[model samples]
Target: MEDVMSLEGPVLKVNGELVLIIPLSAGGDELMKCSRGISEVQGEFLKIVIPEWLAGMLGIEEGDLVCVHNTDGKFHISPSSPRRVH
Candidate 1:
């Protein structure tokens, strides 16, 4: 949507919560604020409450690669293990 056209920035975790501060490119060029609650944490996967609008734009589904980056550092996630499948 044009409302959230330019939403891209570093990701952060505060008080055991994940927050994404996206900047809005339209309507005043202000920052579009949004956050997702932590539903569960399993091993390397963190179940977060992703916004429907964002989900559609990102084309993310049940299982997908979600790279989390912050001032501390960055990390990448894959659906499958790095080891041999067979």
Candidate 2:
């Protein structure tokens, strides 16, 4: 079977600021290469500082829903609007 991973929910905040943080083990080197220029490289993870330019550009707001997708190690995060549950 193929290995696949996915997560859905809201963005996270650290020290009162929103961020997109992922572990190196999650995506390997590919994520680092992809996160360059937009994220800060910490000890074992890449943290993307969000909530201003990024959030505005993507129309993402605090408490907004988000979807996280991992494919072959790489990760993608997208904003989702509130939807009524069935």
For every model in order, what is the number of clashing pairs?
0, 0
Please give the lDDT score at residue 38 for candidate 2.
62
* Decoy 1 TM-score against native: 0.29
RMSD of each: 12.9, 5.0
lDDT of each: 0.34, 0.64
Candidate 1, run of 10 with poorest lDDT = 26-35
lDDT of 2 by residue, 1-86 (tens): 64545544556778888876667666533456545666777888767767577676677766777765556656566777644448
Compared with the true structure, what per-residue lDDT tens digits does model 1 show for residues 1-86? Answer: 23332222333454444333322232112221221232333343333455555545554444344443222222222223123337
**Local error of candidate 1 at residue 10 (angstroms):** 19
What TM-score quantifies how close candidate 2 is to the native fold? 0.55
Q: Which window of 10 residues has the lowest lDDT sum in candidate 2?
A: 27-36
- After TM-score superposition, the amount by which residue 54's alpha carbon in candidate 2 deviates from its true location, in angstroms, is 2.7
Q: What is the lDDT of residue 37 in candidate 1?
A: 32
